[model samples]
Target: MARWQDIEKDAPEFAERVRARFGAGIHKTIATLRKDGSPRISGSELEFEDGEVKFGMMDRSLKLLDVRRDPRIAVHSPSLDPPKEAGEWLGDAKLAGRVVEIPPAPDSPHQDAGHFRIDITEVVLTYVGNPADHLVIESWHEGTGWRRRTRE
Candidate 1:
């Protein structure tokens, strides 16, 4: 498992772009596993603080319940439509990891809310390439570090 700082250390530019995508908007999406082994999607927001990626859920939120039952999770940055000129598009980012629960602070407003920090397993950034004819995917994975691929 790697922290956000590890990515910054290994691939600073790529990490910066990925963080920009997440920071572009406040609302993102999160995926979790249901009790029956299916997938569930929920609205979420992420906070990058102190070299960690953290998030919170309302008390007894289904998403929080799912995480407690199964730590595996995936998060997608807020989406935006591709620009009229494909080359102008900013693309999007995604990350996969396991959540570790943290105790809420004593003076918190949402006192019983679930708080967590992710131990990232993977991070990906996908965007349209030059000439607007292909797609570029740059990804970072634990142990393997960084890799890039292109698709037509």
Candidate 2:
């Protein structure tokens, strides 16, 4: 897995898109593995701080518990339908990795919170094009770096 700093250094262009898409809204979708190995999706918010991507949930929350038992996670930026004219858009983004629990600090403000740091394994950015053109997909993996793909 790759840390946010490494991603930024190794894939600056992709990291910029990830940051833009993630910061476009306050809410995002986080996917975790349940105890029974089923998929669980929870609404969450991401913070890009200290050169890391972090998030938290209420202590003992189902999502929190899910990550504690199984750290694998997938986070998707808030879905925003592209405008009719596609010159600019709140691009689509996704992050997948294992969650690293952050122990509450001695002076922590939210004692009832469970914090997690994302150790990103993959990042994906999807953007729109003209109606006749294909959607552009840019992806980065832990060690594979960035690649571009397109689909109609």
Off by over 4 Å in 2: 130-132
Tens digits of per-residue lDDT for model 1 on 27-134?
999999999989999999989998999999998989989999999999999998887899998899999999999977788898789999999999999999998999
Q: Candidate 1, residue 7: CA error in Å?
A: 0.6
Per-candidate alpha-carbon RMSD to the true structure: 0.8, 1.7
Per-residue CA lDDT of model 2 for 1-152, tens digit only, reads 78888889988978988898988889999999999999999999989888889988888899988998998999999898777677566579999999898876689798789888889899999886546367888999987888988888
Which ranges of candidate 1 are over 4 A from the true structure?
A: none
Candidate that would win on TM-score: 1
